[model samples]
Target: MSVATAHVDIVAPAVPGAAPGTVVGAAEVLDRSNRRLGRVPLRAEISTPVEIPHEEQCLVHGWSPYLSVQPIVVTGGRTQQALLSARPANGKGSGGEESRRAANGWIRLWGREPDGQWTVRDPSDMATGGATAVSTPMGSPAILQIGGGRRRPVCTLVPEGSLFTLQPTEHRPQGPVEVRPVADSGFTLLESLRLGEWGWATVVERVWWDEPGVRGTPLFDLAVAYLACRRGNLERAGQWRQVAGNRHEDGPAWIDVLAVDAWLARRRGEWRDLASALARLADAGGTPLVAEGLDLLTAELARPPLEPRAPHPGEALRSVLTPYLRASLPSSLTSFTAAHPGVPQPRPPKRARPSESLPFRVERDTSATRIQWRVLSGPPVDSGAYAPVADRTLLPREPGLIISELGELSEWLIVEDEDPMVLWRLSRTLLDEGVATGVSIVPGRNAVAVALPGLQVRPAAALLADLLGQGRVRRLGLSVGGLRQELSVPDAAEAERILAVLLREGHRSSP
Candidate 1:
């Protein structure tokens, strides 16, 4: 039988930026004999309604190769309308005698089959001449009316290399649904199970551990501990496993728990326990599992070296002074005695032999009552004549007196009622016996002599004595013309005399 042909409009809603009169394309189908079947041309311009009432428009630019359709309900306020237009290849018309067309084809719309095939039908039968009808098939190339009052079957048209697309009439009821492009069932199931397992592990670790009723669940605790071990939190993992042991038949599997225990023991330096646990794991077929423990064990085989203790306070001081004393000594004594006149002579306490140099001398002062003086000098003296003499004196009637080594003296005669006797006694004592232990006496213009037992003479004794009395020693003595000296003693008596001479002579020479 020869098939009859009729033109049908396939309408669809307009997409944004599409030109007017655009259509969706359809798939090309072949018969069982491998012969070319009919081509269903897209005939209508599909459009969506604009916000303004009653105006319909579509996008149709570059849509010539595709077919589009829209299903309609007869009872709606206005049936959704589609305008038909076609542009053939090379800008030819699709509708007149001179129009180029597909070979001897009839139009068919189909409801999608369960086996991914199509069941063809006609559009004319779907729209009756007057009233909408159901199940009316018109001739060999016919339109089947499936719904008006009855539910309509959804029909979809798809083009090659695209997904099948469907549009439903408003009057049609919901039916059986299926998803296309089915995914691999095994892969999907595995991924879902893995995600669920990790979620459960997280809940047990973070939430269940603190929950009142859930805290006693051993399986949950074990799972959490296992995850903790995997994450390298040995301390927390061990605690969780220990708690789980009380509630579960098996706690975190023996091998994993033992490995964590071994790691902890290794950190605490319990090498014996670590070795025992590692051996046990190896015997139980867990040698590879305890690899980290074995590595830690190997590292512990070499012991670290010890550090020396810090020096004591006395030791530290001696250490610091040793080099300083060796470099300084006798030369420094000249500056030292000049700086501190109150210091006593640097003397050996035993009586000196006639050939020996006297460190200091004691001389009686006849001019003053009960006044005995000590004197210091730059070089030790064997004869009493070389000792410093009390050249100047002041009586109680005098206000105060200053005796310089070079015979320069000052008296505060304006204050005579003051106890000048004390001043006189002090001056005589220092001049007779005081010995220079730190500084030297040198001759100079405007320079007074000062006694320095151990150092070279750099300044006159008078200026050195003034500097000593003023206590401007170390800092003031650095200048080139200044007599710089340091002091040292082989014994304590010499040191004591040096101190005494400094105090006595300092008071004697005070202005």
Candidate 2:
């Protein structure tokens, strides 16, 4: 009961789910002990001042079934919002626009000001007086934007149930330290919540990225711009096209980017800018996007839409765009394409018994009526066992793959991995209302991949991404069914480094 809430008050829900333009009544908050916490008034903005401990919980309603709070450090850009809401047993929540107001809470954020001191601030406050915020028109519950216009989004929310995603139109913080999260004076938003009158929070380091201008992979933005312009949202289309233009001036993607511009010029009937962006774009001739942009100059939603993972509109366009990327989480929001080429679409684990996919087994202390996960057969993990990874010579594994030494890999890796492809999609349905466990999320090519030891997969949550936000973790949990299976993240910095590796592939902490 030693939570930071101070029991001052309480309230709750997951990513807001109420219909748009429609307001809801008061949402009540209660803890596992059936103790009444507080209430959250509807449509409240961030800055609840609710300090979350390592673990916390609350029950949700409507399409909004539960409230789970975890603070994450993400550099999704200068500004963005994390959506929270209960889905079916599956991570995919109900229909889109169902619960944009699922849960309401101001993410706890820490940033260094010009004065060089790390202090807490609301996510919305991170932006300057004139910064722009962008988001899908019909996305999840998010904090209010500081400055919203045609360019800035008034609602700061993303879709519910996604494999932790990034978009092209969204800001990219790869190489430059100034644009990176927490590296600069700009505050990186951490996850925290306030739904209605109830404020719920958990210890989590959510990762995010952002950008104010239009910049994503060239080809993707061209396609987006073509569709946006045709749909009468020239302002938005121009935004995507601008990103495409910034990406490259002479290439297939660039050619396509310009065709849209030329097409737009014909429509609005103007051109001639500070730089001849049009000249460089049309340099490369007959590109997929260019042809399409010209063809659809006078059409309307002729094709539904295109996403990195979605099925392509035509085989010809597929050549330049490769395969259409399906959104990591399908929802009502418009897709904001980015330039993460090798990243695959997320495929969350299918429903199944834990023993089939897990190296560890579950047991019930019937006497205590408590459930827990334990390693199949192993003494306590040696905390000091993490030494340098024994170097191994590189071997050609396939035409495009090679095996290399585990340079910085920890030596105490999972040795009991019984199955290499086991992925368990934990059920979101909790039988016990008050049970809350601290957990970590990893961004993966496939569905919500939970990181565990010895799993073969690319990193999901970047270990480096966590370094600036909140480092690796501050201890968390996962509730399987209604049973609270507590996983401990040792306080040692080395242990955290190892856990980051394990969670990067998306799994609960190991023994």
Candidate 1 C-alpha lDDT tens digits along 279-320: 655454311111222233233322231112422112332332
User: Model 1 segments beyond 4 Å from truth?
Assistant: 1-204, 212-219, 230-235, 246-252, 286-511
Task: State the C-alpha lDDT per candidate.
Answer: 0.27, 0.26
Instruction: Give the C-alpha miss distance for residue 456 in model 1, angstroms.
Output: 99
Q: For residue 135, what is the lDDT in candidate 1?
A: 20
lDDT of 2 by residue, 317-420 (tens): 33322222331112112121222112222232222222212121112111111111223355423222111111111111111111123221222222111111
What is the Cα-based lDDT of residue 344 in candidate 2?
Answer: 22
Provide the lDDT at 156 for model 1: 16
- Model 2 reaches what TM-score against the true structure? 0.22
